[model samples]
Target: MVFDASARRRLAPYRMYPYLLMTVEVPSRGITDQWRRTGLARLLAEEIALAT
Candidate 1:
């Protein structure tokens, strides 16, 4: 999704939550580099879907 300034402001607080939560807390932290991005994207999609 294309985000504007408003979206950035809305998400600024929890920006690290998703990345660190899924990576640091979960053992799946094994995912690194390119694949790491894919994992984070899936996490974001799940969040958006749940929010909707």
Candidate 2:
């Protein structure tokens, strides 16, 4: 899946870290919003809460 500019900006901070294990969450109804990931592939999931 691909994210547009707005989504990329919103998620930019999370993508900066590729080593440590972290979680991020963005509010959206899209099915791709949930996953277990690491590195630059990590994105908004069902756990970590972030204020957009």
Model 2 over residues 1-52: C-alpha lDDT tens digits? 9877678667756654442233333223233433434322434331123323
Q: TM-score of model 2 relative to the true fold?
A: 0.31
Clashes of each: 0, 0
lDDT per model vs. reference: 0.63, 0.43
Model 1 Cα RMSD, 1 decimal: 8.2
The TM-score values for the models, in the order shown, are 0.39, 0.31
RMSD of each: 8.2, 12.2
Q: Model 2, residue 42: what's the lDDT?
A: 37
Clashing pairs in 2: none
Model 1 segments beyond 4 Å from truth? 1-17, 20-32
**lDDT winner among the candidates?**
1
